[model samples]
Structures are given as C-alpha cells and as structure tokens.
Target: MEMQVWASLFGVILGGLLSYLAQFTTVRLAARNEEKRQAAQRAEARRSERLELLREFIAITQAGIRIAEERDQAPDWDAAGTPEWFAAARNIIDRLWVAERMIEVLFSPQMYQLARAYASAVDHVLWRLPEQIAAEGSMWDHLRGPQHEFLAGARTDVGSLP
Candidate 1:
C-alpha cells in the first residue's frame, strides 16, 4: 500500500478508538452521577420521615402529661379545664399514623427503624402514664427512673430535617 494511504488508515482507526473511549467515559460518569443523585434524594426522604416521627413522639409525651393534669387534685391555672396535653397526644398519634404510611411510600428500612423506635417510646409513655397516675407519682420522674431507659430509647437514631 502507498505510505499516505497507510497513514490515513491509521489516523482513522485511532480517531474511531478515541471517540468510542470518550463516549464510554462520558456515559459512565453520567451514570455514576445519576446514581449519587438518587442516593441523596433517598437520604433526604428518610431524614424527613425520621423528623416527622420525632415530632409525633415528642408531642405525644408532652400532651399525655397535660391530659393527666386535667384530672389532678389541685386546680392550678396550668391545670385548667380542656387538657391541651391530652389533645396534643391524640393529635400527634393521628399525625404519626399518617407519617407511618408515608414512610412506606419513601421505603427506606433505616428510616423505618428510626420511626419505629420513636413510636415505641411514645407508646410506652402512653401506656405507663395511667399506672404512674394511679401510683400518685410524677410521670416525668417516672420517665427518668429505671423504666428500661425509655428516655435513652427515645434519644436513639433520630434524624433531623432542615
């Protein structure tokens, strides 16, 4: 073959290889970026779910105290009629039940675990409050006591959302 023809063939082959490699690298990088973006979106969704659970848990605990106070022996203004705490508890539970369904929509096992922990803490507070009331003991103090470290459980793995 002529030298010029050989040179032309070599140049064309090299250009083709370079083009293919460039496209391959670009596609790979784009795929990687897409994956990272998806992961970040999933993480944000989970954090949102976790924060919702925390809000409900806190609301329930705070409101349960108020509901009980409505039936208190003393009528401190803080103990006035219409137990806000009781209402708060019921409201939080109602909101949380919906949040639980939302967690399924977002579908992250880790987030679900955090949410479940919050639910458990709130449930414990709700369940134990009546007993503490019957015993004429402070429920807040009861929470601080060795009630299987309920407070600690409440503190575990809570994710905050901005």
Candidate 2:
C-alpha cells in the first residue's frame, strides 16, 4: 500500500513536469512566429518607403530634363541667366541633392552611383546652358543617355525586390 502511494506521487510530479515543458515550448513557438510576422511587416514598410523615394527622384529628374529641353529650344539664350531661370534650376538642383542623399542612404552602391550619374547629367545641362548656347552646341543629347541608364537601373532594382 505504501509503495502504491509513492508510485502515484512520482507519477503526479512527472505529469506536471511534462505539462510545464509543453507550455514553455508552445510559448516559445508563439514568440518566434510573432517575431517573424513583425520582421515581414518591417520589410514591407521599407520597400514602400523606397518605392516612394524612387518616384520622387524620378519626378525631380524629369523636371530637370524639361528645363534642359526648354533651354535648348529657347531662341533667346540671354534668358538663361535670368533670375527666373536661376530659381527654377536651383530648385531642381536642391531637390536632386536631397534625393541623391536619400538614395545613397537607402540603396545599394550601384544604385547610388547610377543616381549620381543622372544628377550629374542634369547639373551639366542646367549649369552649362549659357556656354552651350554661346558655342551653338547642345547638351540635351548628352543628358538622354544618362537618363535612360538611370531609369533602367531603377526599374531593375525595384523589380528585383522580393
């Protein structure tokens, strides 16, 4: 009878230990799942932010291209140095600088380099307008190559995101 009581007590302790282990393992698995879900959410948020930044950069670059085109086609080169022209050019450049910095921070080195090339092309066309006009030459042709390359790189970069 005494041996039976001892066996029952041992069984109760063993059962409680097994129950505790099961609960512990379940809690750990739940925590791991929560972490995985949060990580996915963070990744998605980052992708969205990157896409928005890319869009803003593209728009600013397009604005610069339009300005360059306008300067190229203008009959009066004298207007290139006007305050209005300066303000417009400066605004684009300022925006480009901000976008470029953000790209550098958020993108790969190759992407940042592509952005730099495009920004440089825009800068060349905008700042060299007077010289090009005086020489009866156009940098509009030069801007197109860099613009195309940057756009292609950007598209590829975005497409490759998972």
Q: State which candidate has the highest TM-score.
A: 2
lDDT of 1 at 50: 62
> Which lDDT values do the candidates have, in the order given?
0.58, 0.86
RMSD per prediction, one decimal? 5.5, 1.9
Estimate, for each residue in 23-114, the C-alpha lDDT of model 1 and write its tens digit.
Answer: 99999999999999999998888777666665654565455544544444445534443466556656766765566556545535655555
**Cα RMSD (Å) between model 2 and the true structure?**
1.9
Q: Any idea how many clashes model 2 has?
A: 0
Worst 10 residues of 1 by lDDT: 145-154
Q: What is the lDDT of candidate 1?
A: 0.58
Q: Which stretches of candidate 2 lie over 4 Å from their true place?
A: 130-140
